[model samples]
Target chain A: MGEAPLSWPDGNDRVPYWIYTDQGNYERELEKIFYGPVWNYVGLECEIPNPGDFKRTQIGDQSIIVVRDAEGGVNALVNRCAHRGVKICEQDKGSFSEIMCPYHQWTYDLKGNLQGVPFHRGVKGNGGMPADFSMADNGLDVLKVHVRNGGIFATMSDKTPPFETYMGNRILGYYDRELDGRSLSLLGHSRQRIGANWKLMLENIKDTHHASLLHVFFVTFGLFRVDNDSRVEMDDTGLHTALSSIRGKQELNDGTAQMRSFDSNLALNDPSLLDVVREFDGDQTVVMQTLWPNVILQQQSNTLATRQIVPKGPNSFELHWTFFGYEDDDEEMTARRLRQANLMGPAGLVSMDDGQILERTQEGILAHPNEQGVVELGGRGTDDADHMVTEVALRAFYKGYRNVMGL
Target chain B: MTITPELRSEIADLANAYALAIDDGELDRWPRFFASDCLYKIIAKENFDSGLPLGLLMCDSQGMLQDRMEAFSKLNVFGPRSWRHMLGAVYTTGSEKEISARTNFVIFETLAGKDTHILCAGEYRDIIIREHGALKFRERLCVYDTTMIPNSIVRPI
Candidate 1:
């Protein structure tokens, strides 16, 4: 089939629209991108800290079990039985010596090697004539795995770029500053489904300009003001970008529009929720890194998480927002973090309204598939393209996507 | 075990009134169901087991709960829809003034001419208290049995 043309505003040819909706494009992504030479974020090191620890995870629709073996070495193996294609690791995550499939009781070690198959040797030595059937030949597929600063990554393809090279200097710097050897803690998780294309989901997040206007909760609470000066730095690769901004503090007596009501008295009611205010430099900025294709690295409003987008069907996608904090946080701090988590989850004050809007936006797309969205928010010129609030970042995403898809 | 007739009647009335207020979209009246200092959390059973603090809806203090109601009615945008909540079997335990009651409920929502289907099936773990002359909820944890919510749980379940 022929590709659909994409027309940019200023006569610059955009990538084909089929990249967003076509089935053929999805198949190519599965092969060349997801299963290709890209490093995918699996989970945090804190998730499986001890020996016999494990977590069932997916790498591009392929089920792979990530386990820290008895020797404390992390390993990832495809969750499939070699015998009849049944899943070898059935459970989501738990400690186990070996996985025993219920279908035929075929057992496999944590390394995903065939340990034993019940009745394989033949009962009473009367039957079973396959002498050459070796268990060694039938084992789970293992992928090369690595860890960087407590972050776990896996790649299906052997020729993947080094983890450091793939992440680039910009991304590594952010991780170095933010993570900073702190013991990672598992705060909680929130999942929501938005009825828009997966790319749009990533775009909506990394595009920092929407916070002031799109997210009313931010405006109401005085967490971030719209007039803040921020910059969107497009990575050298164009796939990732950094959004940095310091929202000035709202003067209590200025009578400026703040979050909730004008009465500062109500803000003091829940001291833990909206207790402190800080200068623009001290303002915690959200650095969003779109790790091409599926994973989105998000740091915003004291909330750190990696939003894993899994497209279930054409109409919708599932977003698993796993929140994390430093493990050494005190009980009070943890509670405060949990209370503050309401800023971006499904029920988050800022995010609760987003899902509904996204669903409706996609629904509206049905009316005009041929028509395209205008991405001239930052500027028209490509040279001065580093602005916080523009759809130019989306254009950068499409650049990386097209390169990956060979469009 | 002698089921107290008075306790059962009061709990039943509270459950019915709670569902009616929410489904009818009575924003201000819903807060009357809870105490001034209350904990209202509606979380999935999956998240609870995982030790995650996240909730489909987490509200501490009637003010936060009231804040959500305000957002729903005034700030947050949603489609034109109506919900019919079917509250079933109220099991009350503890003293008359301050008791713990659990009730099973199924909330049905309809939008854009679509009929109401079961959105979520959960139990309301309520900590009831008598403040002055009225019965108010000190804590209401809407614990949902189903982990995978239907489509998008936009409205409160």
Candidate 2:
């Protein structure tokens, strides 16, 4: 595989379409990028708190089983059986003494060690064990699993940098802020299949410039303001960057009234829903931290979640979103979390439009490769840029992508 | 354990009518099955008693339920389908203002060319209100036995 003459835009400049709608590039991505020496988010530590508790997950299209072994250590391994390449585990999540394959009743322990097989000694010794067959040698393939502040991450290639080095101080600090001495409880899930490249979705989030415009629902309902200012940071590591504090029109005076749409205003007809409680006295931020290729950590307003993008193909991808809150949250706070959950997923009022928008973006890119998607926004003159609600974050993302993918 | 003939017949008819209204896409007429100012929620039983406020569907008031109906009719996009509700049992607890009833429901959906199959199987916990010479639902909680949802749950269960 030959490397492309790749470079990140200085600021707001156009980007190549191969990053979005190329099947060959997408396949290369799965090999040299996703399953490469990059840290991939598998699950959270709180997901399987108990020793025997486990959650089935996938890392770069490889079906994996994330479990807490008898010693309360997190372990991630390929769910495939060594015998017939059948998936060893079937259920989504549960606590089990052993992962037993329903196909032939072959059993394996929580550590993914092949324990027993059905009828090892057949009648009259007709079918016994091979001379070289060993259960210890045929255990499930385990990857390098690591955790930071209850967040679990796995890397297929053991050659990748340590987990802390991969996430860097900025990301680790962000996780510390949210998971602040609190355990997460699985609230529920919302899944949607978008008709676009998975890369488009990730790039879309990193592109904060399009937020106020594409998601008019945010600005129209006064939920998120467009008439605000922010800065984008291009980290020295190239892989790490942050979209800084977003400032919005906090107060309006004079004859300049708010713009309210019929659907937006009419949908939330309940006055209580609009009731003015205490304001959120925290940093009004929309930080998008991308961990190389597959992981996207989003802190959009009050609703926060990690979106693990698994590309089904060049044109399609399955995004699995898991929403959680601290276990110590009061009943009222939990209710507020639930209400805010409607702001992100496919059914979310603010985000339901993203799937369609991404599809359209992919379609346009597929139609025209040379017509580059411009990323020139915050980077006006300076080589280094500040975080702004624009394409600056995306410019930073692709810079990292090029460096890692060697494209 | 044993269902009374009179109550069973009435409940069976009511359940059938409710399913008919919803499956026929008559969401506006569907509210007739419940009283005004009701609590309509669809939660997995795994999360019911655990204090998880979130649900696949949660509507606290009749207005919210209507808002959901409005969303489905105007905004929601999904394949067309008809459904059959196989309802069983009616355990009732009567009070002055309302009656609490428990019933099991198995919903079967038949899409365009697909054969009818079970979409959801759950138990409904309903609070029936009798006020001003009228009987309606004050609260209806569809607590699912299984948490694995097939695809999109576009309509009220």
Query: What lDDT score goes with residue A234 in model 1?
Result: 63
Against the native complex, each candidate's DockQ, computed on alpha carbons, is 0.45, 0.17
Candidate 2: Cα lDDT at A105: 79
What is the TM-score (0 to 1) of chain A in model 1? 0.86
Give the Å shift of residue A363 in candidate 2.
4.4
Name the regions of candidate 2 deviating beyond 4 angstroms: A1-12, A117-127, A229-231, A234-241, A244-282, A285-288, A299-302, A363-371, A379-388, B1-36, B42-53, B62-137, B140-157
- The residue-by-residue lDDT of candidate 1 on B74-121, one tens digit each, is 555567878888887888888876788888888887878667767778
- Candidate 2 global CA lDDT score: 0.66
Candidate 1 chain A, run of 10 with poorest lDDT? A7-16
Q: What are the per-residue Cα lDDT tens digits for candidate 1 across A71-129?
A: 77888888888878887676666677777777888888878788887777789986653
Clashing pairs in 1: A220-A258, A220-A259, A221-A259
Give model 1's share of reference contacts. Answer: 0.26
Q: What is the TM-score of chain A in candidate 2?
A: 0.86
Residue A94 of candidate 1: its Cα lDDT? 68
- Alpha-carbon deviation at B34 in model 1, angstroms: 1.1
Superposed by TM-score, candidate 2 places the C-alpha of residue A201 at a distance from the truth, in angstroms, of: 1.7
